[model samples]
Target: MAYDEGLAQRLREALGDLPDVVEKRMFGGLACMWRGNMLVGVMGDDLIARVGPDGMADALKQPGARVFDFTGRPMKGWVVVAGEAVGEDADLADWIDRARDYVEPMPPK
Candidate 1:
């Protein structure tokens, strides 16, 4: 499925001033990487966040958040925040920050 362009644009704006952020296409959507590590992206209208294994459980507890199961099997450490949950800029940025907090410390891929 195609990712939401508006969401992609919002993500771009959120990360605009951040250094070492790059855009790449993945999971049929636009991925924003931090230091070459996948931080966040848009999949369909949902926000894809790599929250790390430790954060996954709590992230999923949030409203409209779920495991990012692009494939048949669910991927641990990743969560998809539904569009409704990210209608606001602050909410969207919070999700991105969760992903960034996890990926930013890792060595670049």
Candidate 2:
């Protein structure tokens, strides 16, 4: 399936200033990576965010967020934010920031 291009563009704009950020294809979607770590991605109108293991519960509490179940098994620490949650620029930026915060301090891949 094709990913969401509009969401992908928004993510690109938000991550433009960050260092070592790369846009690549993964999960049958467009993955925005930071130093080879998955930060966020656009998949079928959903925003897939890697919020870290510790932040999983908090991230899932947010609007339109749920466990990222790309395959049969659920991926902890990753979330899928959809609908109005990612429709607003502010929310999207917040997710970006959350992703950056988690991946920014990690050791190089």
Q: List the residue pairs that clash in candidate 1.
A: none
lDDT of 1 by residue, 1-109 (tens): 7889999999999999989999999988888888888889999998899999999989989989998888889998999999989999999988988888888789977
Q: After superposition, how far is residue 42 of candidate 2 from its true place, in Å?
A: 0.6
Could you estimate the TM-score for every candidate? 0.95, 0.95
| lDDT against true structure, model 1 | 0.90
Where model 2 places Cα greater than 4 Å from the true spot, the runs are none
Model 2 lDDT-worst window of ten: 76-85
Candidate 2 TM-score to native: 0.95
- lDDT of each candidate versus the true structure: 0.90, 0.89
C-alpha positional error of residue 101 in candidate 1 after TM-score superposition, expressed in Å: 1.3
Superposed Cα deviation of residue 24, candidate 1 (Å): 0.9
Q: Model 2, 1-109: lDDT tens per residue?
A: 8988888998889888888988888988899878888899999889999898999989989989999998989997899999568898999999988888888888879
